[model samples]
Target chain A: MDNSEDTERIASVLNGDISSFEPLIAKYQPRVFATVRRYARREDEIEDIVQEIFIKAFRKLATFRGEAPFEHWLMRLAVRTCYDFLRRHQRNRETNLSQLTDAQNEWLERFHVSDTADSGDAVAARELVELLLDKLSPSSKMVITLMEIEGKSVKEIAEIMGWTLSLVKVRAFRSRAQMRKHLAQLLKECPVTVEPIKTS
Target chain B: MNTDKLWNKLVDEVRKTPSGHSVPHDFEKRIMDRLNSTDAHAKSGDSSKIRSLDLLWSNLVNLARQATPNDRVPFAFEKRIMACIDVPLEVVDGLTLWSRAT
Candidate 1:
């Protein structure tokens, strides 16, 4: 939806026409789901977070000053909500290296055998990345997800997160370091069996 | 392989993974229900009571956290807890929606 339509909808909702918010929800739910899915794995958790985002947008619609597109404002709230979700669930997500599934282990084993090895197993790579992410502190998880996985620039993340550009850059750097520490540990700790290459 | 190279490779692979999850079938409906109920609660003037109950639940969660060995006790957990229940309204709203959704 365009900015003027968004403004009209916000005005309508603020004027007590609650169903006016449904169009906004329809327009943004996919993007919001994609973003929230990065922070949560379960269907229920993703649903709750998405519901919370829209509900929050509905309640806080009055505060949206229209300086930016409604999408930007809503997405900022969504990212922060995901950050809060991460903090709340971080305890349950404490990384146990032992919890690494066979797929993730095999992916690490392949990477260990050869940097040039086929990284064709996208599922395993994704799982390994999530395991490493679970090991990070919440801020690091948020920053790294935005920067690396989502491919958002520091400036864009700063805008989304309401952080200083320097802070975003600093956090991005530290999150990378933290990820490296975890990755190195995984490399050291994960069992690897390299099959010998047969020469004809 | 260098850690940087491996990290970059892994991120590349993950980004290539399609974001396969569509929004749930009835998510919009669930959200509207939650919003409607929250509005009802606010209008019914049960806001303060809901907030206190929500704050109490948050304190209970934090109390449970104190049992974890390495976790820091939130410096006088009881004294500053109310300050931390930032979205108490949502607790009631979330519970109401969750029960209905399930």
Candidate 2:
């Protein structure tokens, strides 16, 4: 649907036509599901977060001033809700060396052996990245996910999150450093044997 | 063998990994059901009671505001007690419940 259609549906919903919201939900569910999946792992948790986002959007629909497109406003709400979800579920996302899968451990071992070595198995590398991301603070995780994984610019992140540009930059820098530190620690803790140098 | 290089490599690999999950088939229906259920629950008399309580509280607040003497000076003991306590005194209206961690 176009902007005019969104405005009309929003008007209808504001006027107490509840069923008018279904079209908006249908249009946005896939995008919402994609965004929520980055933060939550379980199917049920993803669905819950998605439902909460839509429900919240419905309640706050009256506040839309039409200054921006409805999609932009909805996305801003989505990102903030995701941040809250991350903060709320942070304790449960904790990861440690013991929780690493064998493939993840092997990938870490290869990285420790040589920084230039290929991580090779994309699936294991992705899981390892997720594990390290879980170890970060909620704010840091959101910053990293938006800036690095999602390829969002600093300005875009600031806009979506309603944060200052400087704050986003600082957060991006700090989160990268934090991720590096965590990776180094994991590599140090990983039990990889080093081959001895041969002599003549 | 820079750590930065390793992190960059891993990040590239992570980007290559597909997100791979789609929205469930019945998600829109579920959201509509939830919204409809919440609206129905809110309409079931509790809201009217809350509105009445809210209106009463507002009138009480207005009365209390008008009754308080703005020019009254603080008594010496009260001032001393206030000085001793660093925290500001807060009056609870008793309507809000303390939030518990989930």
Best TM-score among the predictions, by candidate number: 1
List DockQ for all candidates.
Answer: 0.01, 0.01
After superposition, candidate 1 runs with Cα above 4 Å error: A116-119, A193-200, B1-102
Alpha carbon RMSD to native, model 1: 29.2
A1-200 per-residue lDDT for model 1 (tens digits): 78899899889988977667767776777678777767787777876787788777877888999989999899899999999998888788766766678877775566445433343555566666667788999999899777766668999999888899999989988887677666656655767643322222
Deviation (Å) of A107 in candidate 1: 2.0
Question: Which ten contiguous residues of candidate 2 chain A have the minimum total lDDT?
Answer: A191-200
- TM-score of the A chain in candidate 2? 0.85
In candidate 1, list every pair of residues with a backbone clash: none
Alpha-carbon DockQ of candidate 1: 0.01
TM-score of 1: 0.61
TM-score of each: 0.61, 0.59
